[model samples]
Target: MAKNNSRNMSDQSSMNGYIKSICDIMRRDNTKGAMEYIPELTWMMFLRILDEKEEDEHLQSEAVGEIFEPSLKYPYRWRDWGSPEGKKRKELQEGHMDDFLNFVNDDLIPHLKSFEEKTNATKRQKIISQIFRNLTHTRLGSEKNLLDVLDKVDHLTSENIDDTHQFPLSQIYEGLLLKMGEKNNDGGQFFTPREVIRAMIRAVKPDVKHNGEYATFYDPGCGTGGFLAENYTYLTTPEISDLKLNASDYNHLKHDGFWGLDNSFTAFPIALANLVLHGIDQPHIGLKNTLSGRETYMDLFEGAPYKFDYIFTNPPFGGKEGDDSKANFAFKTGNTQILFIQHIIDHLAEDGTCAMVIDEGVLFRTNENAFLQTKRKLLDECNLWCILSLPQNVFVNAGAGVKTNLLFFTKGETTEKVWYYDMSDFKVLKKNPLTINKFDDFLMRLHSDKEEDKISEKSWYVDIDTIKKKDYDIKAVNPNIKEKEIPKPDELIKIIEESQVKINESLQKLKELT
Candidate 1:
């Protein structure tokens, strides 16, 4: 066990070093920020990882007596272009900078994009085309910097995956995501905090015991595939649980039980890279705008009216869908959040479960027909069981100050009563964000039939009738807590100063006694 721990630490250290090297190269290259650096960095990393996976796949196939079709020919593979001996690297070292750059932009990208036309192409191959279709050479305009980045990425290999000296590539990729998500632009849309993802996964419990072999998970607006990656991790990792299952169930889930969709051209590749690091060799994340129409991505939903057993996502909010996109939904709304909720209702299977992070406006906004109708359908068709009112700072890092709630529900049952857990009092901020440990009190109350203790002061339930009387308003109001008394800024400052003085006096007296 000690030896294993040592090896893991070594692996972690090595991986972190590689990531630091890449970031250093990015900085030296004058890449703008994570928004510019990550995508360009990811494009190179994707090819390198894909090449390694292909090698592993080929070896496994040979052992199993199966044929492994190669995606890229001799010079096109990462081993050919990315390694030290590779032509691109050699050319860059020899001062043939234009030659190397032109080959990548002119030959390499076009070749990758041509995979869509390959006859009998594997699904992975098709995805390669989909991923590289819009990919442009964003960074790495400098040949020497590009070579430096490639050299760093080339050090990442499966053999070093768990070595104590190396950081796992997945950790590095997620780190880039964290950086990219700090952008206040559209790039920030791809990040939902991993803690939030884990909380939702724990609440929904998407696993084989509940869903069985047909167990499947889908994310309609899967930003950078965080939920899907975490969901896969949750199902595969063994723990004491209520679910009855075996190794095969876990295996099935690891390989074939997840799908994600996002329309953003930029986000799709990052999502693919994220899932790839999670050991999903061929993730079924579609790149279509989910709101474009119900008929969109028919290939993904064959039986179609409702296909997913578990749906989890944080849909893009505060934006209106175009009229062309709105025409597809029954609840004709320009509101992106409403349309996504409607889409979830449409694609969700009978007995399917969903845990989504929705804008706070979704709870009580009934002014528009689209908002009211969507909420009405949600209550009428699903067992809208829980609304976890998150703190405002939950998304502060992602540049969103708009409040959000985690809505957990099952599809087959009608809403009777809704459980509301108000976490607003947690006082979380970007630096001291809410962690999964903080969710234990709420989860315990949810799992047990026992009502919230008056002392706990942050949970309560409301009947469906009461909700209907109030138009399904789901804001969490902890009846046990007394209304807060507002204090002026000056008064609050005086109170803080008084408290500090008392604390200092107590400390001074204790010191004198000692």
Candidate 2:
């Protein structure tokens, strides 16, 4: 056990060093330029790790070890830089030495000789060689002195590499999120708050036990794959230790059960890489605009017969462009949030449940084409379960406070009473000033299944029909009022005098202007 612990610590240290080296390269170049390079680096590192696993039989016996084996070999895998085949392989390897040294320089020529192919395209081969030369010279080589660094990294458990090692990556992603949030990005609408994601996953509690037996899991507007990753983390955490499944079994359940879609080209790859890092190998994440035309929708549903058991997502908020002719459904309101709500309703299985993070505007606004009707449809057609009111500053970093709520509901039978948890004070502080971690408390209460109707300071339940009559508005409004009399006239006069002098000066300025 001591040896194992020491080994694990060493692995963590080496992994940390690799991450730092990559970040240094990005910073030295340019942050924006680094984004392009980082993804390529991630891909190469992934491939190298995969190749390393294939070489080590003991590691291959582990649960996650089986999934990292690379099967896809484009033509570039065969070419040599000095020769035609070497050049092709080098082009695809980017600048990562692991591929150039292991595959192209040493392996490809001998392997491809059986095919009786000669090296082709000398000019293209030279360009590929130069690129590989630059890549081989990077800090990656300095960090990995003799496969010891790679061996050390292989020892890192998923738990050790959580959000910490991924922080720099996350910072880079946050920049992408910010760019998405900016005007003209058109992709910003799908960026959901991480807190909102945690809250939704907490409410549903998707676990490994519920895997094969339960229905599917999905996210329509899966942005950077936060919803999917959170769900995957929720199931695999030590909290679910009692599930007693091996790592391989868990990986299979996750890869097979989780599915996601996003239209953004950049977001698609990021989401796919995020899942791979989180242990869901070969994730069913695809690039498809969920709101595309009916034909496109039909194409998406072509061969899949399974319905989702649970759906958790924060679809792009606000309305989409009205001029786009390829929209899936004709929504009366131009609001895209309503469209996502309808899409959730359409795709949700009869036995499935959904926890969607929607803008507060969808709760109370009562225009003909507004989300009010969609809220009514949920209550009238499905089982409206709960609405969680999240606090402000939850999404402050993203720059939009459109107060959001978690609309939890299930398909099929409608429940007469819906639960409303007023968590307005469940504030997530920027600096955690009060040293309060509200989510810990919130999860405790939720998992306990305490009676929410009985009044509590921060949380309570309300009747579904009552909320319906109020147009399904879920905001917690306290009716208690306190009245106080004004101070003495002399004090009031003194306060008025202070304001009067400033008013007189403003009036004189206006008179002079006239």
Candidate 3:
């Protein structure tokens, strides 16, 4: 155990050092800060790993006496252009300084971006195309810096980082995502805290292939694919739970289980790379404006089922849709969260489950038709089992100050009552971020079968009739928390008179001293 611990420490330290070295190179070469460097690094890391994965696949296929079709041919592959010792790399190194930069800017990027336009593109091809869809040119300003970044990424291959030093490659980007999520980074749309994602997945415990059909997990707004990646990790990691699996189940999970959609052109590629780094190969992430009916590249989502079995997402809050987006939903309004609620309802299969983070205002603001009608539709169509009133300012790290709540519900059953769990009193600050351990009490009572057993000062049930009377105000209002009463006018006058008499006594004492 001691030896293993030492190896783990060494692996973590080495990986961090390597990543920081790459970041330093990026910082000096026009890319500054997390927001700028992460995107440039994302493509490099993804290609490095992609080449390794495909090479392994190629060897395995060859050994099994089967033909394999590689994604990129010849000079386009990372080995030809990016590898430190390869032929093209040698030519670039010995040739004019401008040669390498020109090749990348002129040849490499355009070739990669042209994958989507193929006559009959493969899934990988479509993915590659979408990943590079927005990159019209290279971000690295010089050949030396680009080559350095390439060499650093190449060093992180599976061959270099053996079993003893095998840190998850996904973690390298996760930290960068946090920095990008900071205030003014404009990358919060792709981040929800990992702790929050884990807590939600733990609560949901979404199953896979329960009755022969493969289960599907979806996210409408898959920011850096945190929920999907975490879901995969939770299901696959043995220490978390004992989920017995067959070969078919595992294969299905890798190929068909995960699906997502993102409108942000920036988030779309990052989400793809994030899921790929998490070991999900066929991540069906469609790059489309999910609310506005705008299509970017949805070829990967061609055969997706109309309704999914499970959804875990953190949709962007404070979003307002235009007429084009609002026209599709029955509740016609600009509020994005409400439109998302309606979209989620329409896209859930019978008995499907969804646990999502939503802005708190959507719950209490009943004056808007979209807000009230959306809440009513949710209760009428689904069993809203839990509404966890998360701590206020929970999303401050993401540059958001709005109060949030976790809405967990299953479709095909009308909500008779909702179990509200209040964690609002727990103050969260930037230094002391929220963690999974903070949810111990809530998780302990979450599984209680009896309604009476579930009732506590922090949690209780509110029936449908009360919710209806309040115009579908489904916010978590704790009945146990008593509001402070206001003093009447006469009582206020009496208190003021008593205080004035005391003041007079003090003045008399002062006058005597004078």
Best by the lDDT measure: 3
Q: Which is superior by TM-score, 1 or 2?
A: 1
lDDT of 2: 0.55
Q: How many times do residue backbones clash in model 1?
A: 18
Residue-level lDDT of model 3, residues 1-514, one tens digit each, is 0011122223656767778888999888878788778878888788878887898899999999999999988887888888877688788778986898898889988988888889777888778877787787778888778888887776766545544412378777676777766766667667888888888988887777634578899998887889998888887765664677688877888889999988888888888888888888889998888898898788887788889999998888888789999889998998888888899999998989999999888889999887888899999999999999999877754444689999999999999999999999988876777889998788878976766769899999899999999999888999999999999999999999999999999999999999
Q: How high is each candidate's TM-score?
A: 0.84, 0.67, 0.90
lDDT of 2 by residue, 1-514 (tens): 0012332223434555555554555445443343344444443344343333333533665656554332323432311222222345336457665764465334543333222222342322221221132232332333234233333333333333444432223332343344344443444555565556776777777655443564467887787777877676666665533345576657555546678777665666556655555555555655577765423112222344346777888866554536352255545556777777777888888767898887777777765545677767777778877777777545543345667777888888776776566666655554662222555665666667556533455556667767877877756553232246788999999989999999999999999999
Q: Which model, 1 or 3, shows the larger lDDT?
A: 3
Sequence-dependent TM-score of model 2: 0.67
Model 1 earns a TM-score of 0.84
Order of models, best lDDT first: 3, 1, 2
> All models: lDDT?
0.75, 0.55, 0.83
Off by over 4 Å in 3: 1-14, 159-167, 397-400, 450-453, 485-514
What are the per-residue Cα lDDT tens digits for candidate 1 across 343-370? 8998898899999988888788867887
Off by over 4 Å in 2: 1-20, 31-38, 56-195, 209-212, 240-242, 246-252, 294-303, 323-327, 397-400, 426-429, 433-436, 449-454, 478-495, 498-514
